[model samples]
Target: MPLTDLRQYIEGLRSLGEIQEIDVPVSLDLELGAITRRCYENGAPAPLFKAFSDHPSGFRILGAPAGTSRQPGLYLSRVALSLGLPPNSSGLEIAEAMAASLDLPPVPPVVVDDAPCFENTTTGDDVDLTRLPVPLLHHGDGGRYLNTWGCIVARTPDGSWTNWSIARMMLVDSRRMSGIVAAEQHVGMVAQAWADIGKPMPFALALGVEPAIPFVCGMPLPAHVNESDRLGAFLGRAIETVRCRSVDLEAPASAEILIEGYLHLDEKVAEGPMGEFAGYVPVEPSMRRPVYRVTAMSHRNNAILPVVVAGEPVEENHTAWGIPTSAQILHDLRASGIPVTASWIPLEAALHWLVVTVPRDWRRRTGIEDSAALCQRIGKEVFTTKAGAVIPKVIVLNDDVDPTNTRELVWAFATRCHPLMGHATFEHIPAAPLLAYLRTSEKVASATGKVVYNCLPPDEWGEALPIRASFRHGYPPEIVDRVKRRWHEYGFH
Candidate 1:
């Protein structure tokens, strides 16, 4: 059965020994974020904190819900279980599953009258954003962030379409919070539609919803594409949603908390300097952005807030955004007639680079011998796809080098790719401004360019490829089989 909600996903984690409950007290300040960051860096189990020193009894915090796993057989266990996949599934398997689901028709979410999200509602002056134990993620962070992994639901002016997406939000006051919404994002476009009509856009912030919902929201789908349908396609069933108290948006029925608010066109507030997926906190000044004025607040009896400490690799941003983006890139490449077998966004690269692998004999099969031309074809197609907005660097690999394996990817780039001979550059393309390499001057420019690093040898040299002298390739099959069978007897474990 599909994991219906965040609580169900938590239960699934417990069953697989992937979660660790902490009865000890933890602060809602940087202490919580610090501990969470440490756990993420170490690949430790998800931390469920029962006692928030300042918050009430029912308030709970879950850290690193989708962080990568270090288990022997379940490296992507958290990502897999969140998407209703098996615990032992590989990264490639998960990406392929999501890519295949993109072809399935999106099943719209079912609207219901009553839901746990509406169990407790606060309207009018009673609304208070400070009531929740929002965490101060990093020392350099601007303020307490209320939404990291939460999904923000918004719609077009005529209600023709709805978009669900994840963005970071910081607490401003008891009645208002502010967040960064890029103009290119779906939510930003929807908000702009409302602003063009001279009105505040109604939005609902849903936290701890069904696990698959957040994963889908992080995807960069094309404009007018309903995220609900894509999420339905992911789970192979329609999701149940409940109407917001003060907004036109609908949130996951089983969501732990919901903050209904409006994006005021005239009202702006400073929001930023938070640790981003780029692995560095931007030193730029906080800018005036849309202020989310809280109109209503709702939550379950004993609600839990899921927090994603964004920094380094393997965090929710890397796992949720990077993985699905890779799948989208793969699909786009194949559709554009590029012979891509698999693709990946290495966590260590911090979501800036993408690795795609193709069969070594692809040139022979397609009769395309000009390596530079093939590289340009791939660069133009991928850099123009939906996933291209966030990815700045592309690395093409041969089939022998698995894109999913960081070591193999490094080896291929180090040994096969020549700096001048195998590289292609595309200029005047859109680039994500948050990338640390894009300085103030480059960001101000109309467009930024990207490089396509081809880490594959020339087609003519394929047959003369040097043999890999690794244990598996160098040793006899019988000897390797015997060693594997007696691995435990040899006291290796």
Candidate 2:
């Protein structure tokens, strides 16, 4: 069944031993952020803060709702459950399922008049953000952030398209919030269009919606495609949404909290210096960014706020956004005729390294250094053509090994990859400013942008002859069944 709400999703995590309850009083300051980061690094369960020092009754915070896990194959397991698939689904299976669903008809959203998110409404002078415990996530953070894991819904000036995306927002005051809107991002493009018209852009920030909402927001769907509709297609049912009290925008009906606001063209504030997903703080001083003025705040009684403290790997930044995004990119690339088998963005690379395994048949089809050329082409195409500029390194591997398994990838590199012959380079690809090498370096060169194609020879793409001969294709079915039936008796277990 589809996850109906945040609480149900949390319950599902609990069933899988993926959640921890913390009853002791915890500060919303840097302490909670540090604890969450440690949990992410260790692949531990999501933490439920039941006792906050200054939170309202029944107001709890959940951190890292979906993240990397200690158990093998659990990452894909959690993601599959989030998409209403079986728990034991593999990464390749998840990608194939998503790709198959792309051919299914789009499921339009069902617009309703009233919803639970509007249970309590605060507007104008009565809207006090300080009442809610907005966590000061990191030690070096400038201020409390409220929209790290939230989705911002905004419509175009012509009202032709509505964009849903995950953008970070820092609390500036009771009525104001500030965040960067990059021109390359869909939200930023829509915001700029409204700014050009000299009008405040209407926006609705949906917090703690169904787990699938944020996952869809992180996906790189084509332009003019509504993520809400894509979400419905994935769920195999229509999504329910309600109009905001103060704006024309609509939010998920099951959202725990909703903030209706406008992005003023003239209003700007100094934002940032917070630890970013790249695992480092911005070296440059905070700069002025677009300011969002909150005109109304609405929420269900005793709302549960989901917070994502972005910094290192395995956190919400990686598990909730990065890995799935890479999978989406792989789907797109393969659909566009690029031969991609599996993909992984390693957490150690700060979610920038994308390793894709390609089928050997593709290499044979395209002669002349197909692996190296394909790696360079993919890097440029994904980085410059789409929203994949956030990714930096691209590694191409053979289909024999799992791209998500670091040990397997390392083994392939050690045994097959030739340093100089396998390496490939590209230049002038627009990259995110937050890349560690780009942020800290004094002299940045073109060679900084590079991808490696660790290609195994055609003969080595398949398993060894002895191992292949031992499989079901080589063994008689009766003999194999007898061996399986007597395995426990032979003490194999």
Candidate 3:
């Protein structure tokens, strides 16, 4: 059955021994963020903090709702479970599942009169953002962030399209907050349209909705596509949504908390210096950005707020954004006639590097002997694609290296690829400013480029290649199979 709500998804995690309930009091300041960050780095089970030092009893915080799991056969458990796949499924399997939905007819969301999220409502003078247990995730962060894992629902001025996306927002006052909306993203584009019309864009921030909802919000779908429809396709059914109390936008019916507001064109405030998913804090100081003023607030009783401590590998950013983006790239490449068998973004690379693997048969079929030319072609196509805007590095590997396996990718790079001869640079490509390698000047420079590292042997090297000395490749197949079948006889666990 489809897990349509956050509460249901949390129960699913509990059933798998993937969640922990913390009765001890935790501070929403830096303490909550510290514990969550450590848990992510350790691959620990999701934690539910039931007690907060300053917050009321009717609210709770869930940290790392879909972080990596350490259990055997469940490395991508949280992600797999979100996509309605087995917990033991691989990254590629999860990505493919999400991608498959793109081909199916979109199941439009059904609007309802009521939702659990609207059970308790606050407006005007009664609204208090400080009552919520917003966490200061990193030491150098500017303020308590309330929207790290939240999805903002907004629509164009003409109401022709609606967009649901994840953007971080920081606490500014009891009823106001500031967030960054990149000009290139869909949400940003919609916000710009409203600005052009000289009005505040109506929006609703939906926190802790169904697991699948956030994944789609983070996905880079084509512009003007309704995220609700894609979300419905992901769940294999129509998603239930409720119109916002103060805005025209619709939010996931099961959201834990809904902050209805308007993003004003004239109002702006200094926003961020928070630790981003890139695993680094921006060197640039905070700047004035569009402010979101709360008009109405609603949430279920004892609402559970989800917080993602994004940094380094195996966090929500990697599992949610990295994996899905790789699948999107694969889909894009194949649609463009590139013979890419598989693609992956190593979590350790912080979502900046994308690896595309070419099938061995592709070379024979296409009669492509010039590895450099093929690399350039793939690089140009990828760099110009929407996925390429965020990914700064692309590695094209032969079938010998599995893109999903980081170790194999590294080996292929070290042994098969020549330093200068194998790498090609693609210039005049757009890249995310969050990349640490980019200087403040290069951050805005259009001339900044990306490198496509070719980790395949020259085509002239022929079909006969060096034999691997590993256990699976070095030994005889029959002997290896017999040893595998008699592991208990060999006294091994």
lDDT (Cα, tens digit) per residue for candidate 2, span 245-336: 88988888878989988997578888987888888776677878889999999888778888888877757677656756776777777766
How would you encode candidate 3's per-residue C-alpha lDDT over 167-224 as one tens digit per residue? 8899999999998777877878988999998888899999989888888888878898
lDDT (tens digit, per residue) of candidate 1 on 1-493: 7888888999999998889999988888889999999989988899999998867677889999999777788778999999989999988999999888888888999998998877788998999878888889998998899999998999898988999999988999998989887777778889889999999999999999888888889887778999899988888789999888887778888789999989885788888888999888778878787899989999987788999999988799999999989888887888777788988889889888888888867777666776677788888888886688778888887777678888878877888888778678988787777776886876666248898887777756853556678767678999989999999999999
Per-residue error for 189 in candidate 3, Å, reads: 0.5
After superposing candidate 2, which stretches have Cα over 4 Å from the reference? 367-370, 440-454, 458-493
Model 3, residue 165: displacement in angstroms?
0.7
**Clashing pairs in model 1?**
none
Off by over 4 Å in 3: 445-447
Q: What TM-score, computed on C-alpha atoms, does each candidate reach?
A: 0.96, 0.89, 0.97
Clashes of 1: 0
How many pairs of residues collide in each model? 0, 0, 0
Residue 81, model 2: Cα distance from true site in angstroms = 2.3
Best-to-worst lDDT order: 1, 3, 2
lDDT of each: 0.85, 0.77, 0.84
